[model samples]
Target: IVTVAGNVERPRNFEVRFGTPMRDVIVLAGAKPDTDRIIMGGPMMGYAMPGDEVPVVKATNCILVGSPTLFPPPPPEMPCIRCGECAKACPVDLQPFEMYWFSRAKIFGKAQEYHLFDCIECGCCAFVCPSRIPLVDYYRFAKSEIWAREQEKEAADTARERYEFRLAREEREKAEKAAKLAAKAAETKAKLAQQEAAKAAEGTAAPTPTAGDDAKKALIAAAMERAKQQAAAPLNTENLTPDQQAQIADAEARRAQALPAEGKE
Candidate 1:
């Protein structure tokens, strides 16, 4: 059911099918000569349609025909004087003046933090404003700008993530190539060492020791025996002078006296 009223020859309800063109409905209602705009709903909240060519949907409840007398043009906007009337009239209990200030100054993020999207765009704030400011229009403009900036930020972040991923992938590829080259070089070196060892074992024979070589081996054995005997030898104290023995005795006596004092403590 569709209800078409306001500034028409026959303002009444009609049973219409879905997807019905708004033009046919207007013709049935007979639009008045003074009709200057067509609204999809009531005058308080309905949006003005650009033309009558739009089709009626399931949500179409009322089609209001507006004229100069019924819906006059809005007055020139004035600066806000911090009046609380708009806040009082707001059904959502939002601070309209604060939102207006932020929106006018283009500080959209601050307006959003103040719950700007919670505004229903009911136009009550504008209607009750003593300065006749279009509060709803400012809110709408701020919302659009915030949305556009958010989209731009998201795109930039995605590009940055892609670039970082590309750099990481290139670094990983370079590391893998370097590792493969290092492994190949090590394997080649090991194979060459093994071949050299095999050639030495197959072709080279141990030469007979000369007199000089025998003498060098005998000297090295004697040095090693001397180092072992020195490591096993104990310190000799039999040759100490009488005066040195007396000094050692005195030191031992002092250590014994300090031990008794520490035990007492």
Candidate 2:
């Protein structure tokens, strides 16, 4: 639903598709030729749109057409005379002047301390300000800046966590590999020692192949097979589209071609 009113020849509501352009809506309402501004909401809270080319999304409910005569440019901002008009006009009983001062000075923490978020942005403060200080605008700027900084902080924290996790996983894999190598070396050394003892016991006997050597060879072969199996583990395919599954298959095929056969390097 889009409501095109104020400065249009015909002011009314219209049900249109979500992606309908703002210009089309304005045309339906007979927009004035000299429309100076096309705000996206009510007079008080609406933002003046850049142009009518923007599309109407789910949130677009109002389009306040403006002209020079209907909506004149605001007077140059004058210095605040420390009047209590804005505070008195505030419906939430908030000290608008204090928040305004802090916001203008870029002291957002101070503004928040003064209950800035409690402001309903009803435009009462700006409307009643004798100084004509666009106080609400300052409050909006402070809120947006704070929110943006918080988002950046969250992104930085997430990246740090991912990096830490990757490092831990790499370290764990390296430890496991080192432990396996140490065990294999210890087993081979023990087998060789046993073979030397047996040959010494039989003073003049020739040293032939032993079952221990064959066992050692089998252990190495098993380790290599386990490594290959771990490397070629199947990937999770749940919730993937047909195209995504096909892409994964193609990638795996390429990887298989790049890797050598199990027995070779």
Summarize candidate 2's per-residue lDDT along 52-166 as a digit string, tens digits.
Answer: 8889988889999999999888898998888899989999999999999999998989999999888888899999887888988998998998888889999999999999999
Model 2 misplacement above 4 A: 204-265
Candidate 1's displacement at residue 247, Å, is 99
Clashing pairs in 1: none
After superposition, candidate 1 runs with Cα above 4 Å error: 1-35, 40-42, 53-63, 205-265
With a 3 Å backbone cut-off (N, CA, C), the pairs that clash in candidate 2 are none
Q: Which candidate is the best by TM-score?
A: 2
Tens-place lDDT per residue, model 1, 1-265, is: 8999988899999999989998899889998888888899876668788988888889899999888988889888788898799989999999999999999999987898889999988989988998999788799899999999999999999999999999999999999999999999999999999999999987878877899999999999999999999988876666788999999899999999999999999
Estimate every model's Cα lDDT from 0 to 1.
0.90, 0.91
Question: What lDDT score goes with residue 126 in model 2?
Answer: 94
The global Cα lDDT (0 to 1) of model 2 is 0.91
